[model samples]
Target chain A: MRGIILKDLYDNFCIPKNAAFYIFGALAISIGFFIPSEYYYVLISGVILPLFGCCALKSPTEQEESSSFNKLLITFPNSKAQIVTAKYLLGLGFVILFNFLALLWSMVQVYTHHTIRLTEALRIWGIGISISLLFLAVIYVGFFLLGKRNGTIFFITITCLIAVVWGASSALLGIQTILSCSPGLVICLIFSGAVMIVLSCLVSIGIYSRRYSTGTKNRY
Target chain B: MDYAIQVKNLTKTYKDFTLDNISFDLPCGTVMGLIGENGAGKSTFINALLNITSAQYDQVTILGHDLNTQIKLIKEDIAVIFSDSHYELSFTPLFVGKMLSKVYKNWNQKKYLDYLKRFGLPEKKRLKKFSIGMRVKLEFAAAFSHDPKLLILDEATTGLDPVVRNEILDITREYAKGKDRTVLMSSHIANDLDRIADYIACIHEGKLLFIRAYDELQNNYGIINCSRQFLDTLSPDDIAAYRKEAYNYRVLVSNRQKLKSVFTDVWIENASIEDIILFYTKGEKIR
Candidate 1:
């Protein structure tokens, strides 16, 4: 499993081409610091960071499919469970890294500009992490079930849907009003995201194992 | 005699085709050459043996371990090479070595580096820049570095130049020097098999035709070219397969020496592996 994760990271993250994404992400967060406090969370956490995370999340699957590495992966000593779990763990690692960056940005705002309270910033950070987790869970399930070609279409469709839903909710309820809700709601959202991720991982394992066991030609 | 691989009643079905019930035991310390025509289930059989595809089987034991229940243990001692490289194109040979080191518990880093150096594969060069021959050499380096008891190659030498192919064949011969290692390779190139294989296994249209010792094939199998009257005098038991030409008939017989002595008027030539496969697939069956 560690070997698989390292391969995925080397293929997708630690490469010259992917350096562009990191540069773009950093630039987006830096620009968000100058925006107003209420809009800062929406731009940095909602749009830029999740969008960046989604690209990062989709890369390894695409590369694996293109290179037929998944076929080779089945020959390894690892089981289907370990293979599926490695992808989820990599996603979780990305979510934590992005969330950590968001937290640091919020802290700088709270100390330097005195525009947002630390407590409110923490609340937004928690909500952002939950949303990222849910996004990761859905996209991974799509990649595993639908395969790489159709999964790319699914990814684009889901991204558009999320954008539309976020836009409508922010317009109707306003960002401040939604954030003012009880902390219990954030906790529930985070727990649900965790549960969904676990379910997604299991589904991926079953799909992968069944594909081979049934003698269906693996798409990857 | 001990065996490295024992497969029984193995079958894999698809919507359009099926690899029908096949069974064979590859003895230890010998190279078995798997020969078949296009879409003749050569790769399918290799896939079944490696568990890359799920096939219904009564039993499959490799290197003293059950394939179904002990595949993890079995995989640790076996290495597989396909016609093309399966590693990501962006990966350098150095990265592949590092990644495989973590996957195979018995991976020897020093041996791997030595093989890379010997094969003249650049450690830092990405695979996208590699020639096909170079890519195959890299796979060989990795396969040997792990010290696997069984080496399975599926069309691994399909498109190489003669020199490179001979070099690779020599490496396989060297790898099987001891009585503890085995090699099962499938190839369309019959000459490659004739050069190194200890036994030949031929499959035609999802059926096992024969698995004979290399020496037995050389001494027993013969092709006779004669007139229709001469062919009619031959026994059906001696005729395995034959093709009728415009002027004469070419018959494949199992007993070359006996037929040679009996038929002084006809020309009997020693049959190569290619000739046997051609007759089996394209000629008429007699017995």
Candidate 2:
């Protein structure tokens, strides 16, 4: 499992000779977060970070399908169940890592700038993590169940849907309406999000287990 | 005989194809070569053995463990390599080795590094930069480093140069030397199988045509060139397959010694593995 996590991290994230560029980009984003006037722009980075990590989760499956690396995985000392578990766990780890950073960044921006209160920052972080988890579920379902061609289409469609919802809500519902929701509603949202994530994981596991047992090829 | 792999009534079906009731046993400490043409279910058979497909066999035991119930346990002692590299190309050897070291309980880091060095593989370079031949060698190095009890190679040397192919074959031979290790390799290249396989199992159109010792195949199978009139004198039972060419007949006989005694005037030559496969698969049986 450690092997798979390391392999996925390197395979999906490591780009050659571009370390300085990424470092520079990160530094620029960090600086932007500190500037009171650029808080809105820095929020874009917060959303982008988790999505970027989500994209990394997609690569391992895509590479496996294209390269027949599923064969290699079957020969490993671990069972197929373990392999599936590892992928889901790695994805969960990435989501937590990225969202934690986003939460920290959002808190810092809220503290530095008086435009958004602590409750508003908490609302944004809540929505961000929830959306990220839902999107992660969609991505895995797309790759595992729908397969490559359809999976790509599914991923793109869901992403567009998320974008449209966010855009429409910001324009019509307004940030005040979104942030000023009742605490009870927020608790309900948290419970539903948790249920969705758990259900998605169970569904993903079922799909993977079925595929390994009966599938002729790595459809993912 | 203590068997390394045994299958009984193994069957897998698709709407268009079915690997129907295939059965074969490979004794321990020997190489078994699986030969078949394209779409002949060689890959399907291997996949079934590895439990890659959901196809259920009546019975399958590998290295004394049930393939259905104990596949996870069995997998630890077995190593498999395909014709092409299946690893992510962006990963460097060091990273991959590190990952595998944690994955396999018996992974030997020093032995793995030694193999990489021996194969002239750059430790820091990504696999995408390596040639296809180098990629294959890297897989071989990884397979060997773990010291598996069984090696399942599916066309592992297909596209390789002769020298590299020979080197790979030599490594396979060395791996199996006095270690109670077994190898099951599938190939279209008869020459490769002929060099190392103790037993040859031929598949044609998803069916097991024959499974016999390499020595028995070489010693007993014969190709006889005779006239059509003379071919009629031989019994249909003796002729496995025959082809008519103008006035002469090329017949593949099951018993070389019996055919020789029966037709002393005719020329009977030894049948190569390729000839046997071609005749069995492509030639028509005598009516």
Candidate 3:
């Protein structure tokens, strides 16, 4: 499992995807504030940021190993479950790294505005990370289930669900309830992130537990 | 004795196809050739053994590791290669020397360098640019660099020119002579198998058609050529498979020596893997 992650990270972050990510991160910090602070930035981070993370899925170079190696892996003295854990953990590490960067950028936005104080900047950063974490959960599982191609559809579905929740809570009850519920936002965000992570983990583990090989594994 | 691989009643199901039941054993230090027509479940069988499918129903053991557990350690000594062209030299020969050493604990840098130079692969070119033959050699270099005890080749010689194919087969044959390792190769090319495979396993329509020592498999089956009228007397089941030309007929039989005696007047010819596949496959269509 460690070997798998080392290979993926080597292929992804250490080399290929890292350059793009660092450049994207720097660019996001430079240009994210051009639009108003609320929905535009949130949507971009919630949606586009996770797409970069999804592309980081480190599959074997062979895509799928033949039965000889398949048998080799299962009987290799390490649990396939551990293999799953290492991959997920490596993914989580990348998510954390990305999460912190996005959070820092969001805080800078909060600090640039005189309305929110430094402490409020931290609170907003916390909420941003929570939202990104939730997005990661939903997107990662979506990647596992729907695959990389159908991920955009999954994110759009999640977006629709979030819109419905926001609409129902604000429209049915009025914006007064939202103002009153401001203090509880972080908890709510944490709960949402937890649910998405648990849901994605369950689905991903189910896919991994079985010998699930996807894509055109045969080279020719 | 610790076998290189042992499979019993391994089954994998798909929507359109099922690798019905596959069982074979490749003892330590022997190569087993898996031969089947395209989509005949040769790749599927390999996939199942590799635990690639989600509907996991199988009993497979490889490299003294039980398929149900110990997958990682088992993987440590195993290498896999696919036949496309020369394998990608993603990194330079120098870079591969260092990077691969990190993956395969036993990777021998000098041996890898020797293979790269011997194969005439440029250390500087990224594998994406190499010819098919060069790419395969690089894959062979990487695979052997680790000093793997068991090598699983998935159609590694399928589409190469005869010269390149022969070279690849010779490398594997040389690898086998050390008598401490095994290679399981899947190929659509029978001639490649005929030249090197010690054992042969045939799969047809998702079933283990037969697994036999290559010498025995070849020795057992022969073509019994006869006219249409004479074919009427033979039981269809006795005819494993057969083909028909304008005036002559080519039939594949399990006991060719005995069948020749039964049809004493018919001509019998030596059977190759292609003949057996063509005979059975074409015969099934006619029947």
Q: Report the number of the highest-DockQ candidate.
A: 2
Q: Which 10 residues in a row give candidate 2 chain B its minimum summed lDDT?
A: B83-92
lDDT of 2 by residue, B1-287 (tens): 39999888888888989988888788999999999887888888988888877675678889999886788778888999986437777777887789889888899999999999999999999888998888888898888877888899988888889998998888888887856899999998999998899999999999999999999999999999888887788889989899878877899998999878876777789999999999999898876
- In order of appearance, the predictions have TM-scores of 0.94, 0.92, 0.74
What does fnat come to for each candidate? 0.47, 0.62, 0.19
The CAPRI class of candidate 3 is incorrect
Q: What share of the true interface contacts does candidate 1 keep?
A: 0.47
In model 2, which runs have C-alpha deviations exceeding 4 angstroms? A17-32, A35-46, A147-150, A214-220, B261-265
Poorest lDDT segment (10 consecutive residues) of candidate 1 chain A: A211-220
lDDT of each: 0.83, 0.79, 0.66
- lDDT for residue B212 in candidate 1, whole number 0-100: 95
lDDT of 1 by residue, A65-130 (tens): 777778678777887788888878887887887888777777876788776777777777777777
Interface RMSD of 1: 4.3
Evaluated on CA atoms against the true complex, candidate 2 attains a DockQ of 0.46
Q: All predictions: root-mean-square deviation over Cα?
A: 3.1, 3.6, 6.6
Error of 3 at A167 (Å): 13
Error of 2 at A83 (Å): 2.0
Q: Deviation in angstroms for A15 in model 3?
A: 6.9
